[model samples]
Target: MSSRQTEVMPNFEQTLLKKRGSALTDGLSFIAYGAQAIANDEFSKCFAPKPRNKVISYLLKGLKAPLSIAGMGIRYFLLLPIRIFILFGASAGFFIALPIVLRLKSERLKRLLFKLYCKAFLWSWGSKIRYHGKKPVLDEPHIFVSNHTSIIDYIVLSSHGFPHATVAQRQGGIIGYFQKNILKLNGSLNFDRSQKNDRSVIAQKMREHVFNTEKSPLLIFPEGTCVNNEYTVLFHKGAFELGAKVAPVAIKYDKSWADAYWHSRTQTFSSQ
Candidate 1:
């Protein structure tokens, strides 16, 4: 090879090696951080198996085990088919009515349909929602921010009332199709973080959406990621940057029934 080719190849190999090394370092750091968190019982409290104790806890577990097994069996054999039926039935109804809803001029009807659809899906998932506090007025131009624990957070919020717009990451497959269509109807924004300047573009759009009186309030999860409900992480300030009244919505899960946390780094949405 020529001298120029030889020099360029070495530089290219060096750059590739550097990137691999950096990735390895990041992976190690993440593992170390997770290990530290687990050691502190932070992870265990949220995700790890139930803590074993010598007396009351063990007795409680022993008592609960048979009931738990029975419950699981009943759920898998009986409730599972019912839930599946409801889910598909609801989805079919939504899509079937969507075309007719679009042809109508009544925004109220559209919003009502959306809310009902969300409620149906949540019900299929065996979600027992206990919404507290006064519901926000649908006409107001406010920023509704909430803590996000799982993929179902949006569904739960939308069931109460449809936001004019919501910020969500672009997704793929059947989920992506539903997300795109639902958000399109609401004039919501979907962003690809991997794209250049996407955040700034979405931010500008959000500002416009918040100030427009004709549009209803926008919903945002400032956390920007799912966290186990036991603790919170630092929130992104983008939601606050918009010149609109920021209403905080607190969501807590009853861990006795189920854990809603989605560890995205280690699990896919479907798996979770």
Candidate 2:
């Protein structure tokens, strides 16, 4: 091919590439963000659209009726109820059980319940996830910080079902009594960020969770408070200072945080 033809070929291909990437952006960005994996690619990974290799396209390629029925039946009969039960259990534990029973103060329960709560949310709410492209992995137990839009971030990260500390601001003593109590029982390290000198002690504990002994991934929302998903706020240094890789997950919610405030009336991430 001539040099002129070479230049012309790239322009034609690039034009098609731009169109495909752009079309997906406007509609899919606000959903579960399976497409965000395309955006989540790191430095060594360059942006390249494969005409036949898009993630979602592949999932729907040849899926037949039998498998589709099995998927729904499984999710409803098995996955969803269990998830909902765990969520309600965790919620009750947060509001009723743990508070009445002081022994629930244990951090193990906190972490465990958080995982169950997250699992429930993902299985029940977030649809059957099919990666059309790349996906995020919990390589090491780092403080995973996200823009606090919905309580779902916890469930979203937790659905992956990894162990880690989840810190909350102990504003109304609500956290200390219920939220902190159950979260600790669930294998979480709970620290009230507002308490004086809590950072140093919590830092040591967090470092322990991140480095010493962890069965799963720890999650943190360092915006310090939940906000609208319209924009991402500045992250708190606690997550980064703990020496864990900060996995910045931008949860594009179908609705606003204000629309679904379960954990806190204003602050603290409570159990769903």
Candidate 3:
């Protein structure tokens, strides 16, 4: 009788809404296509620790997601050269057009532009970083520190431009040259850990960059080496000595180390 009445008086929107709203009687959810679909696709398996077939399907979807990432290896390799040309072009263009441009450079607008540049740089390599911590509103300046697991940390920090700085290291190839200029342009202090006297000089420079002015937060990677999924490496005191209070941050992800291959536990573990 209920089925017959539903069929005769079908309220398609209401009917779909109900179907999309709940878990299944078997303690699982019904999976369907579309945004906010008739069901949630990923549900826990019953009577077992591992996922059921439905869960497996959802996991597979996640695994194949990185194949969906359009560019990574090629773009990352080409990024520095491209940016170098871009920098040159923009600099020349800005100087030539400075008289003609009319938009007032507001302090608020400059900050917004800085944020946009940071986010674009981060996404260029097809890598995404998920952060877990209390995101500071940063009414004032402060230092940031993280585990140097990958070379992408600079982009992560660049997204926040409040006159912040980080320690600089040697350039290997393209990224090194591109990054050296980027950091220099942004006022980063170069630190050569291999040198004895250079260490003090570097620290003094960092202290000045962070403390001598309005006191922007210092960003440092306590673990000097990028961890290979092991526990954090021993922290160095150089970054902390500048009288900046520590704001410890941890970045962990299943797919990040792989960079672009967003799915599959096998690749995930390899990245870790």
Q: What's the alpha carbon RMSD for model 2?
A: 14.3
What TM-score fits each model? Answer: 0.74, 0.48, 0.51
Give the residue spans of candidate 2 off by over 4 A: 1-117, 121-141, 161-163, 171-178, 256-258, 261-272
Worst-scoring 10-residue span by lDDT in model 1: 1-10
Better of 2 and 3 by TM-score: 3
Candidate 1 lDDT over residue span 131-224, tens digit each: 8988777455678898888878878888985634678888887668867877668767899989979988998889888888666568898988
TM-score of 1: 0.74
Q: Would you give me the overall lDDT of model 3?
A: 0.51
**Over the stretch 1-272, how does candidate 3's per-residue lDDT look in tens digits?**
01222232235446556664444631332222232332332221111122223532443466564653433444556766676566566546543543343256343444344455556555443455655555564543356787665555655665654424567665456556645754454456665567788788877777676654443345677766555332355688767777755666666534423432112223332252
Best by TM-score: 1
Reference-based lDDT, each prediction = 0.75, 0.55, 0.51
lDDT score, candidate 1, position 10: 34
Better of 1 and 3 by lDDT: 1
Candidate 2 versus the native: TM-score?
0.48
Ranking by lDDT: 1, 2, 3
What TM-score does model 3 achieve against the real structure?
0.51
Candidate 2 lDDT by residue in tens digits, 128-244? 433233335555756566677554556565655454556665534544564554466544665565576887887787778777443345667877665554445567676787766
